[model samples]
Target: MAISGGRIVIAFVNVIGLALLSCVADGAIQLAGRKHSLHIVRRPRGRNLAGGDPTVFNVMNFGAKTDDKTDNHGPFAQAWNAACQNIGPAKLVIPPGTYMAGQLYFQGPCKGSNPIIVEIQGTIKGTTDISEFQDDGWITFEYLDGLILTGGGTLDGQGAFAWKHNDCRKNINCQHLPKSLKIHRVNNSVIHDIKSVNPLGFHMFVTMSSNITVHHLDISAPADSPNTDGIHVSGSSFVDISHSKIGTGDDCISVGQGSTKVSISNILCGPGHGISVGSLGRTKGEGPVNGVLVKDCTLSQTTNGVRIKTFSKSTPNQASGIVFQDIVMDKVQNPILIDQNYGTSRKKAGKASSQSKVKISDVLYRNIRGSTNTSAAVSLSCSSVFPCERVELVDIDLVYDGTGSTKIVQNPTLSALCMNVKVKPGEHGLIVMEAKVSLGTL
Candidate 1:
């Protein structure tokens, strides 16, 4: 009877364990089903059930081929036309597969009470033949307000062949290559969850737009590819770029002239020139770039980190109310740079002049700590004639890490070069006196 009781207890315990396991399995299945349902529900609806109408136009229904070789420009245009004409909120869907396309433009003040959504779930492969594109972008959306461009797909710019033909660096008259994506004069828009790779020129260009938000993007290209800026913003205001990873050859984020009230945060930049405010003042009669903020950024293995560059002999301009704070740099070349003589003429004058026409003032660099690969961790080559004023640096701690044989040893002990600028104590009253190295010999 004792052996029978023990056997009965063991059987009971096994049954309980099996029941627990079954319950766990059932819970997992239910969770997975809920997740799937959420995804389906989040997807753009084909029919407006509440309004009793169908407004979603799938590109495949208009004859877009999924085989990846056929050009889908015609079908895409057809679908765009139908969706743009829809009276209510409409969606243009590109289903999952590779679709080769040429230069396509979507121009709108789309006929809708609500914003139009372009949902891409597949790859849009750009044609390698550069002649097929007449403008500077492979795909462009122009004059569109209240647009929503969200996708989990890729925009592949086959730029390797065209990169060889690019001669913009050597010749000033070089033809401009096409950008992967360009949004011109578009306002109140959102671009999220997209991957842009290997563009012939810039990965994405935003110009003449306002109130734009770009987030959750993965932009990349080979480090050696020239002129492939991850994101270039010009003549735009009230723009925000956050939570993006950008690695490319040129500036990860280039804020051009006439850009104001811009905010950049939570960005990861590497294998490129880090976030740059200007290359401003290169042209005459340019407007002021003001009220820009770059914070909480990580730049690793980049050429420069947190830079503000302006031209010397250009028209008078002002770059003011700029802030760079809470940045982490890992082995960057120039961790902090404020060059007022950015693109000086190659013809050297008999006398050295530090006069820059650009008025760079009210710039702040705070809580910047990093290891710089160069000895001069902080370089401020401001203009002598129109000197930079009210430039403040607080809690900046950068170390030189170049100790190998191949490293250039010119001024290896130099920590900072402040030419002609006014340094003020920050809000925390933290300033580095030793970093104020006067380079009078330059």
Candidate 2:
């Protein structure tokens, strides 16, 4: 009846394995703890989209109005409203004319038995100060099953002057954020092949949605535009964004709080803050973000390539299982960054309320090959109590243009590291024992 060491180890391993398996099963079904009751692939189109049937509705030559350049709202709104309401398996087509509208909203139950595709050939022209922007939600989709928006046309936000008006000197309380499109609680939606330009605020904001796929979309905003994140996804799960080009004032992709299972690939970002995990915090109580993966992306002239920022004072519910792999950085400020203490003000930081609560852990960066303009290529700073655990770096080759102190700084929290880090001539890569971990080498 003697318990040997080997048996004890085996028993412990088995228990851990079971726990992991259970977690995977739960995540696979529920999807990042959102409890979203939607499935990715729909059934076809017999009565209830029975076995993956394709349903196409065209919005062409079916009651459209004409508008002059001076008039911004005439035919476009008429066509969109009509098609969105009348057609089954809807396709709100914008044919090759300049149709104008103030604001458009895609209301509830916008789905049929088959996958819905909204094809556009013309454009959805927006008005600057029609006063409808204040009232309209600009394409709001709620609780829909599946949506496909494929078009060669554009959705012009006409938001430059509106943005300036809101940013006036006197109107400090003006909350004029002009978003091109907004989607909420939609499951398994696809928005692609479309051009979105000059959004007043975030180009596309996805909230409380799941299993969304955004591909081949081109989003652009002026460099000086404030709060103009290309794609701002919040409280969503299982998002796959790929093969897209985004350039904006703020982060190209800002994964806000309560977002998880985010997989991004083949993205080209420039003239903006690179893809980010957070600026996570602000509200009194909040949820965590986990299971984020970014790979095979390219960044150019971006402030930073990969970043995770949390407030120093605000208590983070949980953040784990984040990874960035196969990234190409071009003139990026800092290719890798992890800041645990994230928030606006450092004076009021949140505290960890309980031990059972989750913390940021298991962040990995691998296969990052690139060059920077004149800055550190890697920087990581985690929480003091629950320091980033299991931080790994494999096959990372980075170089600076000049001798910009290519060195690696080692810290206690940074354990189990394999830095094959190198830099240009006259630069030093070293491990500096500073307030946080700084690992650089040549």
Candidate 3:
């Protein structure tokens, strides 16, 4: 007998009520007299939970073991298929236990109007061996819209062994290490209350996606771990990353080329390179970066804070309309850096004849107060050929504290350095630096 849609809703509510009561009374009900497993609450037949109830597809029912030894990739795939095929809202639940998994990819335009939710309650540990996964990441959720990935669980990359092979700095032909999590082409999604630890590469990589928000995430790796950027966004736009704690070796949040309209606020970054706008012009014909805002963020003991870097001798590129305001730094090496000759050889950059093709304009730094370990608080090493234009600094109070030491210190002074850059007064009608060029109100 086919149950009507209305009856299905009532049944679901009743079941949920009973389940809650049982949970309140004695924690969890045993399923089929199983010693350590909870009962699986099945939904009614022939009726979907589109707007009424959500079908729960527990991964354990599909032969996933909680011992953290067996590979649970097959069970996860099985559960995902069932959830994606459902005619309504569905949730794939990972219960409270440590589970070992190889790379798992969830790709979907689900069969329902509502979004699919992944409620992870247990730790998902990835394999240490790099050859286990085919892609450059452990878990990838792609081509899914209106998705929510939440729960107070951990994604453990166990990257201590893999970090030894990362030689990308010395060798240009290095193999890229696997990131912890990759979200590609997924729109209108939110990821919260998650922790990614010890990734061999970037902790979270978002590319070719839009309208996404990531909040309340704790991402960490060792300070010496190479290339472990906390969150890296490339070729994506309309993203918001807030209220997060990120500590790693590389940039806390790196906004790469072709990305625009990104907002990063209230971020706690430490023991890493601070937030950056670009290493743009690395390749020819790359797009520009615009409309980026980094405000209300704190950086402690970072190598650099609030940086904008571009390579020299690259194809023509432009970076404009960027702002970094109300940021606090502590014992940072370089509090504010705008290096247009980044990654260029010293011989090539110092030739006195080479000119950078990347144009930097309309950048403002306001209310940036902090203490720096080195004397040079602000280093504006702009290109000699195409100098930075319309640069403004207002209410910047950076002082040398004489507290710590770094390798990059070269007779530090409590002053700013401007090389081949033009200055302009900001909206407040003030220029803070004493450079050789004349400053004019914008």
User: Ten-residue segment with the worst summed lDDT in candidate 3?
Assistant: 21-30
Per-residue lDDT of 226 in model 3: 89
List, residue by residue over 1-442, the lDDT tens digit for candidate 1: 0122111111111011111100111001000100100001112222222333438999999999989799999999999999988988788999889999999988897888677888888999999877798889899998787778887989999888888788876774477688999999988788999999988899999999988889999999988888899999999888889999999988999998998888899999998999999888766778789888898999988999999988666688888888888899887888888877665554531124535678887777767876666665677666666767666665565655554425755544534545566444333643323222121111
Q: Which number leads on TM-score? A: 3
Write the residue-wise lDDT of candidate 3 on 291-362 in tens digits: 788889999999999999887776788888787878998888788888877776777875545556788887
Measured on C-alpha atoms, candidate 2 has an lDDT of 0.61
Give the higher-TM-score candidate: 1 or 2.
1
Q: TM-score for candidate 1, please give it.
A: 0.81
User: To one decimal, what is the Cα RMSD in angstroms of model 1 from the true structure?
Assistant: 19.9
* Model 2, TM vs. native: 0.72
Candidate 2 residue-wise lDDT, 1-442, digit = tens: 1123111010111011111100111001000111112213222222232234333334445445445353434444454555455445555566676666666656556434544556767767677664666642565566677777777888777677766555522443356475778888877678889888887677888989888888999988887777788888889888888999999887898888898888888999987889998867545577688888888899987878899877655554777778787898876677777655444234433344311123565666666777665445555555544555445444455555333324423321211111111211111522221111122323
Output the lDDT of residue 63, model 1: 96
Better structure of 1 and 3 per lDDT: 3
- Measured over all alpha carbons after superposition, the RMSD of each candidate to the real structure, in angstroms, is 19.9, 12.2, 20.8
Q: Name the best candidate (by lDDT).
A: 3
